[model samples]
Target: MFLDASGSAPMTNRTLEAFQAGLADGWADPTRLHTESRRARQLLDASREAFAEALGSRPEHTHLAHSPHAALERVIAGIFTARRGRDRIVASAVERDATLHAATHVAAGHVSSVPVDPRGHVDLEALARELAVPDVALAAIQHANHEIGTVQRLADVAALTVAAQVPLLVDATASIGHGPSPAHWDALVANPADWGGPAGLGIVALRPQTRWLPAWPEGDDWAPGGVLVPAVLAAAVALQERREQLDATSLRLHRMVGRVRDAAAAWPGVDVVGDPDERLPHVVTFSCLYVDGEALLTRLDREGIAVGSGSACTTSTLEPSRVLAAVGALSHGNVRLGLHPGVTDADIDRLLALMPRVISDLRAEAGAPEVA
Candidate 1:
């Protein structure tokens, strides 16, 4: 059974149907004056409305971007461009590379990173201190850590940013569909594909009172050209479906992840990471001593159980996970299991049954000494 559900997920049947129907109905240019274009316009508007409602924002304030990375960059660029006098970007150490890179670029390398605890929770006092600093353009924090799944103290962070009068840019790309994001952000960006929607659609929302301007040249302001109407329709449909089942899905995945954590922790030289009780329901990460991340993942893949290793976002690079490194964990030999709604109990069982032997054999291959 394939168990790797790290960054993206498969679309549900209902969402697929909506996408198929939209392909036939929403193909025209939404900005044109033709009847077909008008139909496409309606589809785009309806999809934006549905997605905006999910985010607790008005459709007028939301924009469709090509991807979550684009949306995040747009938000950061807009804020920094409008607040020209301020050149500093404040963010937590555990945020996505997209957030850090964009913030750094916009702020001219004046980005200040707040430290996080070993469990991946941000240091609130340090964050407040950083925000209080002058010339701070914006502060960015994720709703949760994509790698370790530690939910941030966003409400408290929001309070601090508000007190400091700095715009808060929240990256909810990892947390939106899995649970309710805090309604305390000044600007927010999310990924549709992360929640089992079609790829290539991103949701970006801004509060009405927020100070932001398009940083791009005088062209298509929000999205460079436009968004795919069928993709947006599928994303909206998928988000609605996920929201309808959020509570039950969260509970079920939480239990299944707990099983994985428990099973992994019982093995020798294994350390389970993240805030166990207050983490994302679907994500669990752990580090194994004397085991190579790639080898362990390869063994699991060979055993018909696919999984993820290294940085959740930059898994292709296979570099030691910066998230794990920040939290002072062993970054080299880690595995991240992202449990989706489609992962069955039998799948979890099969993984649990296979892990001990896999770890033991890998340790033996490494000529590693036994853990005390």
Candidate 2:
């Protein structure tokens, strides 16, 4: 299930076939003048167009990068280049590490952070106040948080940034295909993995008249003429297919997540995170006091339930989730269940039935107080 849609659903046969074809086509350099190169170019263009259509933007405005991280770096560099006087950057306290790090790296002035509510929504008034500063150059906020699943008021934040004349960059990695459209930001970056596309690809969309510069010096080594052909095509096709299934899939998963949240509420010491009504439909996180998240994740893996832990970014340090910490949510034994097409009603029911017992046993083993 983890190999599939973040353990939510399985990939369609069509998507798999497309990926296979792309791989089988082999390593002909896309920039060369051979017939194979032209074919690769065509594939890349089609993919860009598909991705642009999915995001309600023009293909010319989209830049295909090796990863979402790369795309974000480009956007940040662009904002800094375009802005004249301001050297400061503002971001939400709960931003993805990649975004926060990039903002901090490029910022020549103070970097301000807008705090989140206990439920994880951005403080809009605080954001406005930060943006009001004359030296603020850019403001960034995520569409939906990765760990807690809280969706931000993007349109409201975008309007605030616009009023301040500061460019807004939105990281839509968690909510691109499954949530509301991101037509508000000056720039947006979303990963294909969130929408069932293969990894190694991300879509970056720039609003009309938005000027951006690349972080690295102009060289072919970086983007190879700023084009990632095959991966871009695959991502675009995957996004298109995912968009087609989004409405119905979202409704189905909403019901499933609702059941999980309801059952989790009955578990002692379990504190479900995020606003029940205003979060992404497919994700729900809960904290089980006194139990370690890594241990809970391992036990669930043994039970054939592939879920994510909030304790660490696996790729980086083995620390507690920064996202949860920012929102003041429970930090211990937190697990996030991200539903994909592969997860069914029965799967959710099984998890709901087993989770309470699992938490109870773990708490007992840890000698923690019983959940009221």
Model 1, TM vs. native: 0.96
Candidate 2: regions farther than 4 A off: 1-10, 25-27, 219-222, 225-228, 312-318
What tens-digit string does per-residue lDDT give for candidate 1 at 273-353?
A: 999888999998988888877788878878887777763333676567778888988776688888889898898988888
lDDT of 2 by residue, 6-43 (tens): 42234567777777676656245677799887777778
| Alpha-carbon lDDT, every model | 0.86, 0.78
- The best candidate by TM-score is 1
Overall local distance difference test of candidate 1: 0.86
Worst 10 residues of 2 by lDDT: 1-10
Q: Model 2, residue 41: displacement in angstroms?
A: 0.5
TM-score of each: 0.96, 0.93
What's the residue-level lDDT of 55 in candidate 2?
75
